[model samples]
Target: MLLSIRPSLFAILLPLLLSRHLPTAASRPAPPSDTWRSSDRFMDAERGTHVAGLSDLKRYFSRFGYLPEPDPDANPTDAFDDRLETAVSLYQTRLGLRVTGKLDAATLAEITTPRCGVPDNATLAPSRAHSVGRFAFFPGEPRWARSGPIVLTYAVSPTATIHYLPRGTVEAVFDLAFARWAQAIPVQFTKTANYESADVKIGFYSGDHGDGEPFDGVLGVLAHAFSPESGRLHLDAAETWAVDFRRERSAVAVDLESVATHEIGHVLGLAHSAVKNSVMYPSLSPRTKKADLRADDVEGVQALYGSNPDFSFSSLIESDTTDSGSAAARRGGGVRSSCMGFLLVLVLVIVI
Candidate 1:
């Protein structure tokens, strides 16, 4: 079957073969959609009625702030995170989502919309050039950034950028949220004077965007991030986004900065703490305010960044309450002590 006997055909095929082995002139993938993949199978574990994977729990609660304590002893058939119900009923009630806790198609659609996180990467041109606060990342690559202070940056999709608080008022509140964390956890957590100049950068993205972790459109797994050098903090652009911070005052809202602060803590290498009051708690509550960064938070950050030069905002940041900020925050509950939580950290670190 002499299919390609012509000399012209042979010549044209030679260039195609040679091009396959040539080094890419532009770095990063040409088509961003190339990274999208099937949903993480573990998501089924969060079906809410049974045994669950810790990572799956993180992915699920990430959609909301955190998952409320479930009765693990409950029947598995009714509990696990199934394709039908993305979140539990009590959870929907707490977040003011019809309080049904059951994630119907409409509810699922609302939460999995593209406005939720990152950007719609329907089209990705080789970024004309590298962005500020950007760095190199390859799968399976070992860490390279300085182990010390760092700043992470990622391209947020235009749609999801709203989550970054582009509105002046929201941005201000969001900034204050981080400032509260900075003030609260200064004992251990800190950012460099020149965050824009830090060696490490955290970039937040959305959808089946960069880093191979794709958002599963309202079904399972809201977001994911790489540790340290991965410098990638990605949100599922398909998730429902309620970046509103007036949660305590209003019916349903979320503190964008609060979650950002928590994820950034992960970028700094701190893991979740069981201490419920700590900002590092795996899940967050609608009732929680920026004022919720408790003593456990300070202890966790102080563990990584040190004190004084390493950490120093005000001893008051670690105080149980404050009178300084907004009237709404001032009237909030006073500080919560972690007597057992304190002992827990000391014990976990093997100091006591």
Candidate 2:
């Protein structure tokens, strides 16, 4: 009787155990190849070259606001015309890259990087062009209007949560991300249970889920948030979003908090920054984490919202340096002991 019961119990528990450990479709790494990364072929191509794929590059330019939208009736061609040259020059200038009006290696490299869905040239006016510095704003400079000290409430969408990450973990990561911005600015952010009533709503979506900006899967567009008062932040569900880099070792895993913090900057009225080190910079590399606010970031946000009285730039730098050093030390130490211990327990449970 005892032997028969043991087999029955094993049969029941085996499926449960496998389910817990197995990777879901959402957790898996994106495909090894990306369509946008194919722009590598145009690495040395320049104006007047007329490569067969140059037309595809033109569509890419139009997507990012560098070039005007193609006419519906006209057919796109392989010609790299004067318009393409001007657009490339403008892109180089905005990103602080060498202003070469050609599709040089550096330009192509930057073009293929995973970036915020927000257009770099949104709301650009001729008069404000000269006055804008390293940091920029969304066209009319939209910002959350407030009368006094205000507390903004944000909620994670219950219907659109990611499958791999726990709901609590997502909330915690977002909480910390919001706190980082609140540390520098006078605004306060609090999590609320009400999704409908909340001032800010965040969701993870794949493909076209409405609101015009559709996610292009994997490393193409990591995420996008609407400028001020819209309070809608959407992350691509297809990417492997990792909270702990040590555990989730996928080469293409994106840092969830890093993205959250960056998008929050967008929700607060800041546009993409020319300063690469700043949080508001358009692109982020895979397997890399960058959540701290640089001086450029702080200055940009503070211009829109007054600074927090207790904020100290010197202290922030010291803290960030110390934290980075400790993180590096941990990474150099190899697999964490906790992970090893957990694996040991898992093996023991299976054996028993």
Candidate 3:
């Protein structure tokens, strides 16, 4: 039996069908040979174990400010150097894992986890243990000078290579992110039509696009933003950015709003927070959304720019959702479907 539907009905159902059956992380094509997969090497590097010929792991950790790179003139034969052990301990401490001086299974899992593009050593102020107020500031606490209420103009790059979500959806999510920060501060953000004229600019790019920082495709580094005055926020275009949890499904889906909120903190001159639940904390797992600004984040930003007189702090907003955020993220799911219905619409538009 043939199921017949009118062209009008087909057009109405097209987007719904495509979004419902979109590709999951498991269904997506495998990464190329050159792409880095963190989990593949962790098993061999566990806990006080000396493994030779794994300099690449040292270099990998060093690149992200995890451990300092070995001296250029140091003996090549030395494996799992002392510097790496110390750094691994520090990394474990930061992640709230056991302070194993070596690569233990738990430590390895945390280290290999996909996180924010921001470097771990980005200039954050010294943190106090167990303090929800342990928000770190960039060196010298760089912030936009606030003599009074400040209005910052921002713009999104029209040429951004964002394929997973619609450009308007991206902008809307960003607007909400900025608004979250604005609710707590004296600063007001205005979206400008001109990208060049805007004080802060946001865009998504794939590889090296000339701004010193190059994006490594997918999972590794999701996005990064400049501290204060620089006002450049960049997201990896290669990511499967999910704008809505239910609407846009993917196993490796990253919440655009969550990342935008974090990067926005950078735009406002905030550094990574020591508090794991704070929005400023570096590293986010896949398929999760964390847009809520925590007390630590609020305190940090307010310290820079005094709290907004009109804003009221409610317990409803103060409750942290970090654990729930990670719980919602998973790396593997079901099958994927083709987007033939979408392509048909695009072809019609081109013809017209």
TM per candidate: 0.41, 0.75, 0.73
lDDT scores in order: 0.38, 0.72, 0.66
lDDT tens digits, residues 52-160, model 2? 2556667778888888899979877766679988988888888878887875545655665567888887335322333434888888888898888878999999988
Better of 1 and 2 by TM-score: 2
lDDT per residue for candidate 3 within 42-153, as digits (tens), equals 2222111211223545765666677665688874433556777777777766655677676444444444445676666633444434345667667777888657769999
Tell me which of candidates 1 and 3 scores higher on lDDT.
Answer: 3
Q: Give stretches of model 1 more than 4 Å off.
A: 1-160, 163-174, 177-206, 217-223, 239-252, 290-292, 309-352
Candidate 2: give the clashing pairs: 123-139
Worst 10 residues of 2 by lDDT: 42-51
TM-score sort, best first:
2, 3, 1
Q: Residue 292 of candidate 1: its Cα lDDT?
A: 52
Q: lDDT value for candidate 1?
A: 0.38
Question: Can you write out model 1's per-residue Cα lDDT over 1-352, one digit (the tens) per residue?
Answer: 0112133343332222211111121311121332234335223211211112323333444434444434457522322344323444433433234645443323333332212222211122222133321121112223324455433333333333433234444334434544654553332233343434543333334455556555544323434545555455554433323444332332212345556666555555454443334455444333234435555565555444444354454563545454435424533232122233333333433431
RMSD of each: 21.9, 16.6, 15.8
